[model samples]
Target: MRKFWSKFKREDGQVMIIFAFAMVVLIGFAALVIDVGTVQVAKRRMQTAAEAAALAGAQDLPKTAEAISAANTVAKLNGGSLIRTTVKAPYQGNSNQIEVICTINVQYSFARILGFTDTDVSGRAVAQKNPQWAGEALPFLNLDDDYLANPKIVAWEKTAPGDFESLWPDDYNVYFGGKFDDHSKTYFTVDFADGITVTKGTVATVKQEIGYIYGQKKPVYIFSLSSAVIKSGKYNNIKNKDVVPLEDLVLLQVTFDSFDEQDKNLFLTTTKVFDINKGEYPTDYLTSPGGTSATIVE
Candidate 1:
């Protein structure tokens, strides 16, 4: 009995058994880290796709079919197939609000061993169409007051330096006179002296406004002369009409095509106002009834 007890106390093979158990635990931790990291990468990709889709759809708000088509195109471009999407036009009865929900399936790399073959990811965004030009806008004004009531394509002609100074003198005619004063003529000129009411009232501010419009290649909404009431047909009267320069202009919106410095001509791309309340804009016109803007909500 004493000899049997001595043999039973031997520690042979004990270290091997402990090492085997430790190896299994270490392997499991490695799998968890690798799989989790892969999923995180896929989640980020899905998020990017969702944001792009939402912005694309928002640009075509109020039009159910067009909005969906635009969203799908953007999702596909981002390398992920859209699993599902929800588009709400005029969200919450607001004509300008557009909401979009996007979902995608993300494949797993190392998670298959844990029975998670793939995971689903989702993203959402909301965009609003501004009702009108809110603040600082391009300085160009429309040719006729009638353009404000009904927006359409209008052409602008450049005035010779001599003619520009003669038509819009600084002393007598402080305001730059163009199509707004001469309905019979289509020719126009940039009245640098009193062309626009700069919000900042600085030379830099004036240059900024002009530079923005001149540099734009895409169609965008800008303030036109039609937006102004133009009482007594002068600039001094502009201050009394409760209108803010570069802010309030009945010329709610205008789309520019090209500004030719040499020929001195300004052209418009297109001007069609169907459901002016929810219509399409030129180059997705300035975000009102025919405009678009996007933001991520979720």
Candidate 2:
């Protein structure tokens, strides 16, 4: 028994066991540090790539296909492959909004020894054009004035007055000038020289033929000449009673067209009167009125 105890105390091979246990702990800690560092670096790179891709996409939102292509290019250049890209336009009356999202896949290299082969990283970005950027400049004139005349009453006619060829030779001119005018205001008006007795208090209907060169064609209506009145004022009394008072008639319909960025045109048709009393005459018919005052009678 004494000899067995001495042999056991000799500590043969104890150091090897301790050394093996220490090595295992160190290796595990080293693996954690290295793998975690690698993942963090890859994640940062992916995030950057995604941000660049999303911004590139948004800049081309007006051209949806081009935007997607741009995003993918940006992702690839950043050492990441684009996994997904999505672009959404304005919806639900939010006309000024856009959304873009980009995702990328980042593969891991040194961390694979520990079984982490790859990591998925993603990012998103949104952008919108400032509303102020949409406003466009256009030349406009009140149709109520003679400047709209073939020989602009105010401006010299660059050409002969009655020469139909020299008349304001544009579709837009015919559009706005078709309406009637009083003083500086313009109103939709039609003349019925057919001896139609449009009673002052009675409802009267008038029709005007407005022709368009694009899209759709339709006739607009002006209702209830009940508000129509006769105005008599003296500028220099014309020798004959034949000169009609400016207030005697009311123009009530207006038409116009708007062009978008792509040069696509949209037509607008509107009514001219808000309300009319049984015997009340329309006081003014020359000035442009608010849309609220007119109903879309077409």
Candidate 3:
């Protein structure tokens, strides 16, 4: 009898108790693995959606109403919703930056049995738009001091009448890469050589080619050739020229008046860019605001 009692005490009959505790711990580990993976997937999806939202918003910088509307639309399509947003025009000192926040609810499977059914997942993203962009240059002589009057197309002829004189295409070939007769605005831009110079006498050739369409917009980049106006490029010595340079860049809106095929002459009107730099309103807008590139900052 004493031996039986001693053996019973040694066994302790704790197998069921140990197994109950171990089962609880094992279920917790399984839940951690499975639920953690589910949450992570949700987080990744939300992050992508946030990124898309931020990019959409960045496209319309300074236009907060339009930016927010675009961001929300993209977020909904990407299986997430934007919770908060921030816009910084002239963001980070130069580029226009936009930040988007998004969130999602991840449902738990095995973790539901442990009293945790779902969790809220969130993500954030940021994007920036460059303030400066490159544009084709007029490659001509400066018109006047008046901001209203820009490049002088044929010695101060905003709208010239009578017979046109055929222009020498060789001088303008550097500015117009292809056939100019198409009259298509698509050919308005020309990529210049890195070291090319354009001053008053820089273009020694008289030019003509292609036909200019009336009212067609010939947007070009304008720069100050006067060292007095721009202190940075005083060494270039290229005065009385109209062109796009790295320094003192400005935006010019060029519009053609009329062209006579027989006369072989060109006429156009150009004005300062303040009216179109997203309007004349006070903002961090540069001379020209539309750029071709965008990037994700965060």
Per-residue lDDT of candidate 1, residues 1-298 (tens digit): 9887766655445666778778766656766788677666666765676678767776666676777687778777773555566667657786556666666676765556556677776666666643332222234444333453545544333222221101111211111223254322111222332234322111122332233444544444433443344332543322311223332233233466565544444556434322222432234333223223556554
Between candidates 1 and 3, name the one with more favorable lDDT: 3
Error of 1 at 283 (Å): 19
Best by TM-score: 3
How do the predictions measure up, each by TM-score? Answer: 0.46, 0.37, 0.51
Give a tens-digit lDDT track for model 3, residues 1-298: 9999988866776776788889889889989999999899888988888888878877777666777787778888885343333334444554467777788778898887789998888878888764444433444323223334344433222212211211113223332234643334322222332222333331223233334323334444332233233344333344322233433333445455555444433455554453322333212322223333456888
* Count of residue pairs whose backbone atoms collide, per candidate: 9, 8, 8
Which residue segments of model 1 deviate by more than 4 Å? Answer: 1-16, 82-99, 107-110, 131-291
> Per-residue lDDT for 73 in model 1?
80
- How many pairs of residues collide in model 2? 8
Candidate 2 per-residue lDDT, tens place, 1-298, comes to 9988777766555777788888767766776777667667766776666566655554554456665676677767774444565555441233333454555555655555557677665555554433111101011111122211221111111112221111111211122334452322222322322211211110111112122221123222222112322122221122211222223322223334432223222233443433322333244322232111111111
> Considering lDDT, where higher is better, how would the candidates rank from best to worst?
3, 1, 2
**Per-residue error (Å), model 2, residue 84:** 6.4
Candidate 3's TM-score: 0.51
